[model samples]
Target: MAGFIALLPLLASANAAAAEPGPLPAGWVAAWSAAAQAVPPAQDAPSFNRAPDTAGRTVRQVIYPTLSGASARIRLSNVFGNAPVTLRSLTLGLAGRESEVVPGTLKPLTFGGKTEVTIPAGSAVWSDAVAVPVQAGRPLALSFVAPTNAIATTWHKLASQVSYVSGPGDFSSDTQGAAFRGHITSYVWLDGLAVDAPGASAVVAIGDSITDGMRSTLNANRRWPDRFAALVSSSPAGARTAVVNVGISGNRLLNDSPCYGKALKTRFSADALDQPGVRDVIMLIGVNDINFGWMPPHSGLDCDVPHVRVQAADLIAGYQQMITSAHQRHLRIFGATVTPASLPADREAIRTEVNTWIRTSHAFDGVIDFDAALRDPGTPTRLLPRYDSGDHVHPSDAGYQRMAEAAFEVWSAPRAR
Candidate 1:
């Protein structure tokens, strides 16, 4: 994920609320999701040019759902664009090697009974439900074609999943991926995949890059949330539970970034609460807010613009706000202690103070001590060597598994319900 923000004068506010989702459809749950961020404009930075051009191109993306259903729907976003985007065609099917779709599984998708859709700028829409069998842990491919000159201005910048783009034409119905000549590592336009699973509920894992699975193996689905979903499915009582991730890399609890999307405090409602069938949330944030203030500022794109230093009380207040909001929605919220990230004495003190409250205050319905699960016994302030993802900040695959285990122990306990 780009750790820096863009230089543009904060164009259109990507944080503007989309139209109210109204009443959620009954018996439907979010199977997968990626928080949407406005693509940084092309400046001198190479990181700003990551968004793929979608004009008249067929983009196929692979997504894995944690629940099964006989019908499904998709959510698309144009929230950061200045122009309307028209999808001339869209299709879904079981995925095969690379970008290929399994034969006989491909089906067309429509919006409001129409074969195409035009999303207005700064808005998003959910497609009409399509009768398609969805399986848990199975990969599904979603392909769409933009017939007009449409650039991907809004997207999940660090999908950690490989998506394919076809040469200039509509290949939404093709069973083969030969037309798909290029590959991208981000998800464009698409933000969510939902399935009609009665009685099934979801757990949203929200936070910063750690939850976003940054530095995890690409296309491997080894994110801690992904591992947690697997554990949920294997347990006898967890068959009906789903987990969706809305973590934006470099996200903060109290502040927003041009590249990292909105602050957790500001975007929680849209990214987590608004998700269909959401019944629980597990949040791990504040580390960035504590560390970003110390990053040296550069000339062009200063992502940490405000760089406001925070204290334990400041972060505690943020946590209180989230806990209240989750309870107001009648959902159980779990707090996660920030994992070890080798830091200076001052920052480490802030992290320790914040984690102490998360552990002792009982502010949340439950607590997941990720810091304890991954920290070195000999060096409590650093991640265990095996857990460190080479960088002291993020976790390796084994480290992510430990995190999932910690969450599963708390989430699966009889009292947690």
Candidate 2:
């Protein structure tokens, strides 16, 4: 009895320390993330134009394949906004079907102990850590209300998942889906979600539409990165690694596209290197550059701004720059061979040169032969008939699965160095 009484003080102190937020445990790492891009209302789908302004309204965005964790934080971006954007409230919870959130799971999110936060233009902010239990491959809903008017917003154009917006007022805390009437395919404001997963790191997949899963089933989480995430989560090293998709549709390595974000070299720092706990990057870009290089001037497929025509050598130089940048950051970079795309013979020649360089040059720490994985053996320049999503550009679901498998095999293999 006397010993028990003496130990009470020590036990209470330990409990208090555990409850207080401090430096994250060494084991904690980023579980999931998405790159953000500025989208004009006019460029958005017709459904997205319904609610151009977020003033006094709540937007609920559902994210699939949230890696499991004991606690998590959300990242909000104003990277493309011309003016600061103020968020009045933020909430997170396990998602129910569609826009609804599971009851008894809703939790408030704050930034530096405050519910309201203003993210400056061309900047981003991470919310303070909160206790929110999450599971691997599950869906999580992040809801936020903007009291101040917001016009052009930073969003992920190819969410491949459906999200919702409330009519008016602050409905961020509501667990029911009734208040959400407007629907949008893009994820607004929300950029990335990081969870405190012990003994875990992350890999970022940076690329164009192929990596973006343009042809995959909507809301199905069938993107190659998503598939890779599932594979890593269930592997022997599952507890130590996570995968984040940073692919941007229509993105290029040498030229900027109005619909997509900046070129790979311009945004590599933010999209790949800056991601929380990112240790490796898998880059599979350049198809767009090859295709556009072959297009006639003012063919609508070319970049809006005229620039030096791109060639295989120019793209190889771009890859070299990316490799150097990643090396400077002490990150292991893997080069993924550009996939098969619908292009003329001239452009196909360029792609062949790029792929050969990627595979033999040894410029990258490793190589992922996505081209070999998806290309048809009979016609090496075209995607396999079963793998082609009918466009001859993007791969079908089965093709994505194969690509994921190839990536997983490389990731699992013992590194040469």
- Per-model lDDT: 0.89, 0.81
Task: Candidate 2: count the clashes.
Answer: 1
Compare the candidates by TM-score and give the number of the best one: 1
Q: What is the lDDT of candidate 2?
A: 0.81
TM-score of each: 0.94, 0.89
Local accuracy of candidate 2 as per-residue lDDT tens digits, 213-296: 998999998899998888987888655677888898878898776567788889998888877778899999998877664455
Off by over 4 Å in 2: 1-28, 41-53, 295-308
In the order shown, the candidates' Cα RMSDs to the true structure are 7.9, 7.9
